[model samples]
Target: METVIVLSRLQFAFTVMFHYIFPPLTIGWGSFSPIWKRVTTSPENRSLPPLPSSG
Candidate 1:
């Protein structure tokens, strides 16, 4: 009985940690993937915007 309870608690903890880690990884990829595609697809002649000068 005690071993079953411990196993259940371990499974619950594993799921919670997985949920916490997976979303951020997917979200980051979703956001960056578009930028990555754009960079690769953009024309070579197109110039990037100039950086702002520090005052």
Candidate 2:
């Protein structure tokens, strides 16, 4: 009974810690993946406007 209780506590702690750590990582990845893709795909897509034609 004592070992079972300790094991259950350990399992609970592991799951809680996993949840705490993994969600933020996945959420961060999801949030940043798009930006990462864009930046990586087109490094020089940012173009300047045409300059005025001075005589």
Candidate 3:
């Protein structure tokens, strides 16, 4: 019973830790995408289209 509880705690901890990693990655990518788009679409860039609106 004690072993089961320890294992359960470990599993929950691992799940929470792993789950926490993705959002920041997604947010970083989400933020970086617009910056990248802007850099690519600047008049100096002249190759890519204007950045799309978030709405």
Q: Count the backbone clashes (under 3 Å) in each candidate.
A: 0, 0, 0
Query: What would the per-residue lDDT of candidate 3 be over residues 32-51, giving only the tens digit for each residue?
Result: 99798879877898876666
Assess candidate 3 and give its TM-score to the true structure: 0.57
* Cα lDDT for residue 1, candidate 1: 100
Error of 1 at 45 (Å): 8.3
Give lDDT: candidate 2, residue 8. 100
The reply for model 2, stretches above 4 Å from the true place, is: 43-55
TM-score of each: 0.74, 0.73, 0.57
Higher-lDDT candidate among 2 and 3? 3
Model 2, residue 15: C-alpha shift (Å)? 0.7
Clashes of 2: 0
For residue 37, give model 1's deviation from the true position in Å.
Answer: 0.2
Residue pairs whose backbone atoms clash in candidate 3: none
Superior by TM-score: candidate 2 or candidate 3 = 2
How do these models rank on TM-score, best leading? 1, 2, 3
